[model samples]
Target: MAGQLSTNSTDHAHALARQVRKLRETRGWSREHLAIEAGISLSTLARLESQSVAQPGFFTVGAVAEALNVSLDDLFRSTRTNPGLWSAGYEGRDIDSFVASLLDHGIDMVADVRLTPISRKPGFSKSRLGEALSQAGIQYTHLRALGNPKDNRAPFWDGRVNVGQARFRDILRSAEAQSDLNRLTEQAVQSRVAVLCFEKDEERCHRKVVLDTVRERIVVEVQSLS
Candidate 1:
């Protein structure tokens, strides 16, 4: 019998994520091709492989299953089921819950952008977040150019600078920010990627500002990790 993914009913979303990746690789398709077949973007596929999202949305999960030529039941056949833990939204930032949430949502990567990616709390720092994300089955990348400061200044997105802080759109036009975004966009084309920063709420951070703008220009989805 072909091996079926045990989405049976449990909080072991991480293990299931591995199955998803394995199945994807077995088909010998790149993330971009899988995304196209699944009716999703390359970045979304990347997010699922790297993160342990427990209960991905229907379309995302269904699309992946279809692309892989696997039954949804096979993809989600679970040997374990733990409803209590994954039901609530994320709790305080050991980032345990948030990490789990990303796993559930099929978000596989975090591109850290805190100006100085350190944390007074151990888990909040760049390295720690990377480690935590890795443990949760997600990938992490820290782009210095994506960090705040020069990227956050006026005319951040484009040369057309309006009075006040530069919006996310402005920064993308800067040579440095633009280059970083181009790289990220290419990666996103091949993997699932998110802009990770200190502010859990992307609305307040430049990363989110940048992401919102990216959504406008690309086939992208901005999901909150928290």
Candidate 2:
């Protein structure tokens, strides 16, 4: 009967919606928490997930991607294939899809390496970012020692360095810094690890320094979680 066919179609659609919702929740994200990250209204996520609306707009998918810190490719990745979380880029600040990618890779920790750790961007800032990650099933920790100094290693700047570039090697060569990087890599080998910073541009940020140090010790695949 036509009624039976329609019911089957609705069931299938709801099943997919449930999959998407469960994936995001696995990271522990609330609809509101995800909404803020994606730069969308809470009502939008509520409607999408609750209604199981088929073919949600591209902008929504993109926003969800940004919130989750993953890519569109990552969002739809079948769990039957990839069993872990991975790094991904954003399109429309899609936190949902981004979280979906994290779910894909099984990312559990975020090691932040920002020189300033401040941000004009919403989710990139320290506290907000940490909370968002926590809501998304990722642990957050800031490693200030691994970050670049405002003086760029000037001795007199923070008075921690004896001279210019003196502190460079300290930050570059410290046990704490090394420990952080090593810990990150260990996570990558065992789980997924994301390096956090304010700037979207990886090269401009001190995350590179931590990444370089990470590379020296372990075979971590560097990724821009922008």
Candidate 3:
């Protein structure tokens, strides 16, 4: 009987861990964000999600539940699983339309891959965009390391080289770029993540290069929202 009880307890812990992770992902929250929202130490939330604690304390659980805006009973309920990856550009989109497109496609997070997160368009600057996404309940993260250097991209724009033959793939072979690509893939595995840029067309954007590089490492479904 004791052995059976122990097994059940372990199963419950695992289930709780999965549920917590799913809930966090659904809201596009990083562990740090959730920890802050829950008013708990980051390490405690990490341990709880990792199932290092066989049984979390009531107050700890209550804090998490409150932060997630769900009751204890609701926390245990299963959620719809995340789909693979999606991509979007803000070429002609206003902030409202841009966010609406993301919502239409069930995107939980926006991964900005611009080297310089500035734009002539209103509300597209890094700080403003982040605030807008937060208001829309979508998480926004900027991965500048994945952006193509202007020097490298300039030749293609000047017609010295065809855009199709720009050798952008070579950039992905760099150690730093690979590391950022891996990080983006890990985030996508946890939630519905989209690569964001300003080009209205995927073919014209460096984000496609980043997306293709990621695909070589992991299986992903690609969608373009321009």
Candidate 4:
């Protein structure tokens, strides 16, 4: 099953790569220009064209398709199916595009699991982000208790993800975190929700740990939104 899933995912990536490259060249659009118009990073565009990304996120592919003046179905003509519940990161994305992606996915609420709801990125700081989401008709809640402590985050950043996840599991056992986890689980059952973090890769992000923990208490499907 895993192998089949892997093969299907690869096929989707290759399909998107082929269409993106062909369409971009046909339209005479530079990679940088397309990336700028799509509000995605240059590296992401390059990786897609090179067919090097293992699992490109839905929003990332959609943005590229839209930038090239094509439909998503035209770019990825596949039978791949994914869950509605999602997780997202804004590592190298513009705030507008990030929020737009969430809106496109029909996300009604965002569970911010950042330990400190502060960001160096404009429009990402706690207050501004909440305001922006509110204006966009999306609800935002900062679940600080679910955040991984700074001390435990070093392991993840240092490529010691297992160590970080182990330590974060201990944090998840706390009363406060458990309470918030219950809330998150209940809310997820009621609406489309995505946990927010800073890392582009789910494996490196503590939110993956949080989502895994949430899965233990409830059944839900999760996909990453870039």
Candidate 5:
């Protein structure tokens, strides 16, 4: 019975870590801010969020829950069963908030599917975006082969999204794209990755099709963040 109880406590700690991190991010609070609000040291909060604490004290957990303005039961119940795949767009958000949203969703890697990753948006250009993600401890990979060709982009901006999507499907059939797709598939199996693009709407974005191809190779839970 003691061993079983220990296992349960460990599970609870993992759940609590996820819950606290999510709650903190939802409020746009940083670890330091949450630590100060909870009257705990930053290291303690970091350990909790990192699941390094296998059995955090009851009062400490309660303090964190209170700081996040959530009941302990509500926090525990928010634990997700799967990390899943996430999709995001930088349509109207600045770089900081965009990175924040990715972190909020627990994404450790981002797959950029733009053919020419030169964004007019300030920080979204390939190098800048990659640097920002790295600073946030997230890996960024650009899969140029997954990008829709320029000839195929007009239909997405115009009314014939299906036409654009069909053209992109053809692009995916090529050897280079297939190679990248395989790489992305392998990465998805190992990490929480997000497919990123510029369009706010998933249906219009080629990322939708990119995700479709990924789904063909693996069973993944997909969620789009605005």
Candidate 6:
């Protein structure tokens, strides 16, 4: 019975891995993007997808489901039999374009990591943006804690400001930042979440700092959508 149980578990893990790969491929997403979205370590995702891990934990599996915007049951079922799931990170374009992009990518949640959620852009301000997203059946959350400190951000500015990877590395060492990152990870584990900020170029934005920090602890694939 013990041997049989072990064998069953292994089979289940392999099946789940296959399903994960299929869903990712169907949406033209890379492993890195899926890992970031799922808020799991890239190494963990690699092992799970490669069937190197005999049994991934329940929470891990559930996180992957949430990132993919599917239920736990869906992960175990045949991909053809389950609803298609997709998610991607997006920079806020015009309200109309931004909302359209979210809908286009099947993103249901947006994690705004901007220091200030207020935007001069029409319909992109916190209140208006939330209403717009709600009407489109998408959820919006502002993670102000994830924003880089104003002092830290100054060094990155030039003709065009860039997010200093080294500076971000130092900021993430703080307990407070780690706590906020933990919260963001939890959110990502619950649904299809996009990390949002003002800068259209992800490299130029501090939102990338948050994403990179999360990537260190959990394997995740990240993409920049302008």
lDDT value, candidate 6, whole model: 0.65
Candidate 2 per-residue lDDT over residues 1-226, each given as its tens digit:
0001112223333333444566577789888888888898988887666534656677887787767777767665532221122333233454455555654454555666665566665565667766665555455667666777776734433453335334455666777767755555565555446665544444444455556655676665665553
Which regions of candidate 1 are displaced past 4 Å? 1-73, 76-92, 150-164, 167-171
Ranking by lDDT: 5, 4, 3, 6, 1, 2
TM-score of each: 0.53, 0.50, 0.62, 0.63, 0.66, 0.56
The CA lDDT at 61 in model 1 is 85
Segments of candidate 2 deviating more than 4 angstroms: 1-21, 24-106, 153-170
Q: What lDDT would each prediction earn against the true structure?
A: 0.58, 0.55, 0.73, 0.76, 0.79, 0.65
Model 3 agreement with the true structure over 1-226: per-residue lDDT tens digits: 0001123334455456656765787899999999999999999998887767978888998899999999987775542445567878898889988887776565666888888899999999999988776555456777767887787776545554445335667766778777777778876666667798887777667787788777877887777874
Looking at model 4, report the run of 10 residues with the lowest lDDT sum.
1-10
Clashes of each: 32, 28, 0, 0, 0, 11
Per-candidate Cα RMSD to the true structure, in Å, reads 13.9, 14.1, 10.4, 13.0, 7.9, 14.4
Tell me the lDDT of candidate 3.
0.73
Rate residue 178 of model 5 by lDDT.
97
Find the candidate with the highest TM-score and give its number.
5
List the candidate 4 regions with Cα displacement exceeding 4 Å: 1-84
Which stretches of model 6 miss by more than 4 angstroms? Answer: 1-92, 159-163
Among these predicted structures, which one has the highest lDDT?
5
Residue 63, model 6: Cα distance from true site in angstroms = 31
Output the lDDT of residue 27, model 6: 87
What tens-digit string does per-residue lDDT give for candidate 6 at 46-108?
Answer: 887766787688999899899988998767764222111122334445788887776555454
**Residue 153, candidate 6: how far off, in angstroms?**
2.8
Q: Per-residue CA lDDT of candidate 4, range 1-226, in tens?
A: 0011122335445445645765776689888989999999999988887667868889999888788877888666532323335889999997899987886565656788898989999999888998877555456788888988888888999999999999899988899998888878876666567799999898999999888887887788887885
Q: Report the lDDT of model 3 for residue 55.
A: 85
